[model samples]
Target chain A: MWKRDEKKPVVGIFGFSGCAGDQLAILHMEDSTVDFFTSADIKFFHMAQSHQEVPEVDVAVIEGSINTERQLKELKEIREMAGVVVALGTCACYGGIQYLGDDEETFKERMKYVYGKSGETPEFLDLVGQPKPAQPISDFIDVDIMIPGCPVSEENFVPIYTKLISGLLPQKYPMPVCVECKYEGNDCFLLHGKFCLGPVTAAGCNATCPSLDISCVGCFGTYEGANYPSMIDKLKEIGLSEEDAIRKLKMFGGNKVEQALKGD
Target chain B: MKTYKMPKNVFPDFIELIKTKGKLFGPVKQKSKYSFEEIKNLQELDFDYQRTIMGVKKFLTPPKYKTLTFDKEGTKDIIDEPETNIVIGVHPCDIHAVKILDRLFLGNIKDPYYASKRENLIIIGHSCLPDDKCLCQSTGTDMVEDGFDLFLTELADNYLVWVGSDKGLSLTIAAGELLTEEISDEDIQEYVRWQQKRSSMFKTVMPSFKYMADIITLNYDSEAWEQFGEKCLSCGTCSLVCPTCNCFNVDDKILMNAEGGFRERMLDSCTLPYYSMVAGDHDFRPDRTTRLKLYYTHKLKEYIGRWGQPGCVGCGRCVTYCPVDINVITVSEALFGEVCETKEVCE
Candidate 1:
């Protein structure tokens, strides 16, 4: 914990290959932006400011997955400078949706299709070096804390930020989205024979989709002690085939769901 | 208890008089489902519904509510002035469930929050016919003699209102000309016939429900739990809808500026993950099977051992709402069936 005599903790916000939606989520905290700026010494945040320099910081809040060799090297440098590292958003924690396309052949083919005519490597690829399969930052560096969500919900982010600035470790929330869904008083989609992954998805979004009568897509990743086999069985009972159930479970569950499937 | 007969035509005037006592709330249809909502007048009330999504507990211990607010100056309890809320159309099983909650929250150790809410909130129970899902008959909560301020039993053309408390007497007195003390022989015969008819409508009954305490203990290691666990989602819908389930988790949330924060208590469930989790991430019931066992054994067996009554009121909320059909009836039947099949092996 920071002492009274100690200076305000300097914090750095960094992003890698995935969409910087997590940082945007933090920026979207209009009510807390002024307090956030005043509480911490934000030394390096390119999205919010310029003239960014690579400096040793108290905490590094990193978002997105390590998707390239160049980005991985930069991440190592950030790891060296920061005292504490926080993996923000689903991408930094579970590699996000890009984990589904993690195959070498699939990654290369998709890259070629998007940026190349047919066979030749794109100029950007040559400039940035060969792209790597999307993987969470924890695969490369130690992460002190992880805030997992597609866009790192404000309810989770704000409290974590306050704790980080106060030099306290953030608390973990292992509850599933169904907890919030029950609080919202929304009718259970599973009861209605609709496919909802809320039972296994990490909560913090306050059952946002389910409240609106939409099924949870597992964007927040698998919750702790999630019953994967049971969830799949339920999906199948709701008319989803075995193959489709596993595919849906892996949609945003990423490598974590894959690991559970292996254990099963 | 004082019994009064109110003719069908005079009920509207009595209801209008009762509305003046407090905020009138009753079961109202929301889409195909029913919920306890604020009723503007008699037209909004729908007593024909089987069950509301939530029960009287929603008024006592809400899903989420503030408990305390603290800042640099210290802390203050966040108890708002108790409002007199009169909830109508509660079923007898739900009334019994409230009585169970009262034993827990208002007995030797009182919960101030629940006590405050319970003191001000009035429960007006209404009669209900049994459906296929209802098991209140087996649980012996089909007809409640108490735990309600006023219980209105609907007859063919009139209502037999049983005043259970001074609050109920006050309502009757305020009703003045709308209520009559006259009791007819035909009214008694009609009430008896109505009770018989309602009793015959029960379709679901758990065999040896009272003996479940021993059965649950003997079959503690039965494979029935594993089968149910395999299908259980651990979504907590059972606890959420169960009127007798009253577990809660408290959290302190800091404001963005770090100047202040408030403590909040939200409804929690034993079946949900982390319900038995402590600091250092040590979870007592880490697997779904163990959690499922705790949920069933606690409600079905342990509650009986402690309070001489099962924690479940047999309201059939779980029977109606659980995505997978792993309710008290299925669980008790499965365990009982397992014991019967293995009688020779055990003996």
Candidate 2:
């Protein structure tokens, strides 16, 4: 229990090079917005407020992958200044969709495809210092905790926030989305010869898609110690070629999935 | 056991009489599958179903439920007294499954949650014709003598109702004029013929089911387990559909305000990840092969060792529900090499 006279822990919510969905998730906590604002000192959340600098904080919650040299330096600075560094979304934890192209040449080719061989885009790229390959924040700094999702789930976020504010270390289970799917009492899509990554995907979204009869695309990233060879074989049995199955597995799993597939 | 004969025409009125006892539930067809759903009238029930997607266990131990609610003051047990439930059209195998569950939950040390639901539930068994998926003949659960309040044997033109409990007798007394105590020779002959026909109609017989405990032990390290494990999706569908798979996991769900929370209990499966995980993330059964072995061993081998009967009632739910064909029939056949249908396992 915190005493009335105890100082509130300062928290900073920062975003880097991808969609700011994680910060939006925090803002979307409608019922608990007041409680969150009252409990902690949210010193620097640019999405919620402006005219704020990166101050020394008790906790630094980061979102998105590091795609630029400037973001890489700022990430290191935040790690040095904050007591606890949290990777708040799939991008910060696994490099997200932005890191799908792992090699420098592929990144350059994709950049050219999206922006064209035009002049203004090159100047913008020069300004950002040659546009490094998108990488997770943990590549440069030590991450104390990882809350992975395309947009972090509110059920996961709220409880982790509660524990962090209460000065307790939050714990997470490494179970697959199939666990939640079973509890939801949804029919298995795989049983009907449909492609679903639920057996290997992380559990957090509460099997949202499968509850509605849609197959899981595994946007939450792979669960720890996932049995990938069996998942790939199942996908193959469902009529997906081995290549397509591996591609779908790597779609959201990023470098971690790549390493796991390599190890297999 | 007191017996009565009711004409087919008066069965609807008997059902209506029992409706006043509690909310009536029976099997209803949903698209291609069947499930136990609440029904207000008699026409909604489809007695021709082979199996319901879920079983009678759903009413006893729900998929998820709030067990406790707490705040800064203290925690409160939110174990509300559930309403009375009358489940009709339950098959004999399901009745046997419930009896096994009773031995676990209502035995020596009773679970308050299960005890409450079990007390308020009324089981009305119904005779059914065996389909190819039915394997109850091998497990000796093809017919039930007890474990239900009332049991019905459908005849050509009449209904034979057997009262197995005082509640069933009370229901009979309440069902005045709809039933008659007179038992004619024709009615007896019809019931015997129906029983004989049903006993002969079971096509999927596991002749080696009784010897599975020994076979499983002998082939504990067989390569067939690895072959089945390779095909396993680890999706936990088998445990969810199995009437006897009653393991559960409990967790505390804190409110968004962080001021209060509730404790929740949800059904868990041994085949799923983290079912055997402990503190420091040390999982005793880390791979699918070991976990699948535990599931079958506990159901087929260990339960027999403890209760003198295997936990499986030959409901065939796992056979119908598992995405890949990894069920009792396949596992037992593979272990004993009785059938070579799954040739890879036999080899």
Candidate 3:
């Protein structure tokens, strides 16, 4: 009988500056937690445990965006060490909410609003560049896969992780959440004069908010063929202004919105 | 397909006939609103109700379900529950929603849980007399001609029943004793007139869906999103009440002391800040503006492009349920233009 390879595929979990909800969501997978750990060789995970070291790994699951100089440096090093990199959440995949301010002055103003005059002092690192606007991992590194949820859903994570471990790329869910929402049998909020984002946002969440008697806020990123202008009109008909509509789109899928604004 | 008419007096017998097979669910008054619930007596049925507070989607796809359960031994068990039941007096929008779901779960991969429930249950849809809040006609879903096993249309003093499938035919045959053989042409004409009148009652017609994708594409930075976000509480009410919002979160429920656990999938909303949080303390949609934008795009634009159908069916339940009353139609029209006056005819 042939002996099987004893070594397991090395895995690493990394985070950036955000609420850390995605990590908590992963930890919330109580049943799959042990299996997730046992399935791979977790070389580096800073949030779940205290011990941490940068080791070359087969796959690196990165969360958050390239916000600070330290984050950028760390991300570059992770890119060098890992063979494959997966942008694990909306923050890492689409720049999340931190990229709300597209203009430099607006971003600076928002920073001032939060930190005041004393906070304007920039933290400098000798080697790395200054902190620029927050951006998804794809802007800096080639992301092999992207799981785009505000906090990536466990429903998506399990299947995706399984595929990754087996050396297969998980298929992108081209369908929006409205497809699943219809399956769940909730009422459509739009007809009632309520605002909803089910049409343009990606569909992985299965329309949870609507089912619970709320409108979808589009935590998931935009689908491949999202149409923004029409949706804005729909919202406007329901009484929202054009400027407000675009701001909402920029909150999650800022990069895409920027591209769309540029008529790309 | 066969159509027949029964006297208004025969309605009681029809309820009794349905009761012979199993439980019958129909509209019932709960507090101030109408809802679909199990009826043991005919008196509990509300034949004249305008709409139900909740749609009949849950009977097919439940709020919380387990796709698969796994233990430490690596053994996995998928949960499947198939039950036989009947849903009476379903509205047109809800029936359309069910049909959309059928395309997703039954027509495609055949979700065992959804399939099992759908296969066993019988749907009896009702045509409504339009109310002020109803906009189904605007979205082209005011009347459903298919998807239900049997369709009911209320006439002057009776109901005109249309059998849609072999299952419906069998059920009609089983209830043959209660059904009347003779029906007048005037009753059929009156039913058609009522439907036409109902369609006309809807004051708003949703903009053509063909231009929806393009409209959303053009208004990516229209600046209207922030206005709504400023007022948004992020309470997640809009997503919860929407008929087609299907986002969910899965987690494991471990017993005390970490002895064992079962992975459970529960309803989750994108409106919540934690919904997009990642391991590295990063939140994808930290601001309310982006979250709100996501909800609108998914329903009006992204869904139609991907699934070949619009996500929203103009039910108006969200408007009714929202504390802030952020109307989707108004927002969409503001961003895209008036549905009636927009350029580029959808072919």
lDDT of 3 by residue, B110-151 (tens): 767677778878889887776666667666677777888888
True contacts kept of each: 0.51, 0.41, 0.00
On DockQ, the candidate that comes out on top is: 1
lDDT of 3 by residue, A119-160 (tens): 473554333555567888888888888888888888777667
TM-score of each: 0.94, 0.90, 0.60
State which candidate, 2 or 3, has the greater TM-score.
2
C-alpha positional error of residue A16 in candidate 2 after TM-score superposition, expressed in Å? 3.0
Q: Which stretches of candidate 1 lie over 4 Å from their true place?
A: A1-7, A51-54, A115-120, A126-129, B342-347
Residue pairs with clashing backbones, model 1: none
Write the residue-wise lDDT of candidate 1 on B1-347 in tens digits: 89988899998887888788899899998765788989897898999988887888888899989899887788899776457999999999999999999999999999998988888988888999989999998898998999999999999888999998899888888888787889799999999998899988998876579788899898789999889888887778899889999999887777776667778898988987778888788999977789999999999889988999899888998998887788998888888888785755432
| DockQ of every predicted complex | 0.49, 0.43, 0.03
- The candidate maximizing TM-score is 1
Better of 1 and 3 by DockQ: 1
Q: What TM-score is obtained by chain A of candidate 3?
A: 0.89
